[model samples]
Target: MEQLRVTNQDREHVVEHVKAAYAEGRFDELEFEDRLERAMTARTHGDLMPIMSELYGPRGVPMPRPVPPRATPARMHTGPTESPERLAASAAHGLAAIGFPIVGPLIFLLTGGKTSPYIRQHALEALNFHLTVIGASILLPITVVGVVLLPVIWVAAFVLSIAGAVSALTEGSFRYPMTLRLVK
Candidate 1:
């Protein structure tokens, strides 16, 4: 991990704290002068943190931990697409907007998922997208802001479902944006 450099603002903030601590009678004059010097001389977060910790204990200044980047799975098929496969895949996406959000793609997945990788991929995408919609539909209505956006979500889902079907027919694959992809 890279060491985080402390800025002038950080040093000044530490100096202010030292002054406040001294004003509150938390330390003697000599200790105040030592801390003030240390604050002005701090070059990194590590250098300034110890002073704050000494004044207010460990939890007073939290050292930010480095966060790992998240990786989303990519499910794209580049193989040759067949007409029947395209039709099945197209149906998987089209049926979602026709009121079979969960059941339609689920049937396609169970029937053709094992036999055809292309169909499986499309069915899985459709299934996951519909499941996300279902989850949103159930949960979004609980809040005022969510209630207002619920219809918009439904409309987007409808339009995206149509787009997915069209893409499957033409390009043999389509990924829905903002989908959770829980099924995979």
Candidate 2:
């Protein structure tokens, strides 16, 4: 396999995650500094994997998603988009508001995921986002400040869901910002 290079931005991203884990009390001062150094100097995505695994579980570190080869950009938009696929994709995002984040995305994932790339991508994005939210909800309560961010996260999730639903309605493939691609 080709080596996956990490850029300064990637290292910075990992640094932020390490800082959050520290704020959540996942690491002590010494360990936090050590992790921060490692994240800052990481040369490749693989170098950051163990650092994330230390915060989350082994499965939490997401591998790079392989883009499917397509003959043309038109391949992405040429499929049937107005019927069950569009509605299902929209529902995948909207269901997070009703508390079926994991289930709702999985439903469409199992139903149309194989036949519809659009639905599959949305379901995967929603699934990863909810997983991150749930993980944050659990960790943030450990600190007084994290407790405050929890409600803010809740509102962001709701508003983002509505936005994703709108994008789905417009037949656009939408991805949530700052989302860990764990399911991809």
lDDT tens digits by residue: candidate 1, 1-184: 1158988999999999889878876778999999999989888888888898987779865434335346433334563357888888888998997989999899999997878887788889999999999999999999999999999999999999999888878855689999998987
The clash tally of candidate 1 reads: 0
Q: For candidate 2, what is the total of clashing residue pairs?
A: 0
Candidate 2 ranges beyond 4 A from true positions: 1-74, 78-80
Q: Which ten residues in a row have the lowest lDDT in candidate 2?
A: 61-70
**Model 2 lDDT tens row, 10-71:** 88888888887767656579999999988888777888888888776689854443344666
| Alpha carbon lDDT of each predicted model | 0.85, 0.82
Which regions of candidate 1 are displaced past 4 Å?
1-79
Each prediction's TM-score against the native?
0.57, 0.58
